[model samples]
Target: MADATKNPIADLSESEQLELSKFIESEQQKVKLQQAIHQFTSTCWPKCIGNIGNKLDKSEEQCLQNCVERFLDCNFHIIKSLESTRK
Candidate 1:
């Protein structure tokens, strides 16, 4: 993958450069979101589901939901903490 900060479209026309840049940024954001979702699912799956059943039970479903919510809350808390420390 190319470094997004580097100008990979320098030889392109102005409009083309803008379009490429926007596409690259949108793609990068999509990749990041996918990675985060994979990480969260991997981390929470085993922790939430104890038995290896074919389908998730109600309790298992609730556990998975809570696990994801808690993980997101922790992420937000850490971001807020870092922002406070930066100032």
Candidate 2:
């Protein structure tokens, strides 16, 4: 018996199963994004900053921004290249 609230996923209709899968995938992506941001902060903060300052200076700001952007750009390029090769 598939109770609406307790379908156990296996009891779902094909479309419902797919919808659930997409929702889970979206949530997983959000978690991955959070992890990436945490990794970026940990990896970039120390490299760009040494002292505890009242405020971040322009160089520190730029350095952090550039560090994260470069990582994202590299990831994007790699993903694109992989997709092209698969195709």
Candidate 3:
């Protein structure tokens, strides 16, 4: 586990950097998105694709789109509420 205040990725050493490069190349073969987007997509994908199936249904596809929207909405609501309370 990493410290909450510090970035763990920034602490990688020379050998660790080389290893990370290899790992990232392997991951890139499967994913087009960057690290953060990949993480978000992976988390949201499971939420949207809870069960193994031949393919995603229309509802599951909608869930993937809605998941991103809902996350943005929640962030906006929290910011607005906090601003209102501070006033």
Best by TM-score: 1
Candidate 1 ranges with C-alpha deviation above 4 Å: 1-8
Q: Which 10-residue span in candidate 2 carries the lowest summed lDDT?
A: 1-10
On residues 1-87, what C-alpha lDDT tens digit does candidate 2 reach at each position? Answer: 546676477768999999999999999999999999998999899899978889999999999999999989998999999999999
Positional deviation of residue 79's Cα in model 3 after best superposition, in angstroms:
0.6
**Candidates sorted on TM-score, descending:** 1, 2, 3
Show model 3 residue runs off by greater than 4 Å.
1-39, 50-57
What would the per-residue lDDT of candidate 1 be over residues 13-65, giving only the tens digit for each residue? 99998898899999999999999899788989989888897999999999989
> Model 3, range 1-87, lDDT digits (tens) per residue?
656999676789989988999999989865754664675587678788878789988999899889877776886899999999999
Q: Better model by lDDT, 1 or 3?
A: 1
Off by more than 4 A, model 2: 1-7, 10-23
Under the 3 Å rule for N, CA and C atoms, how many clashes does model 1 have? 0
Clash pairs (backbone) in predicted model 3: none
- Assess candidate 3 and give its TM-score to the true structure: 0.43
The order of the candidates by lDDT, greatest first, is: 2, 1, 3
Question: Which of the numbered candidates is closest to the native, going by highest lDDT?
Answer: 2
For model 3 the local lDDT of residue 65 reads 84
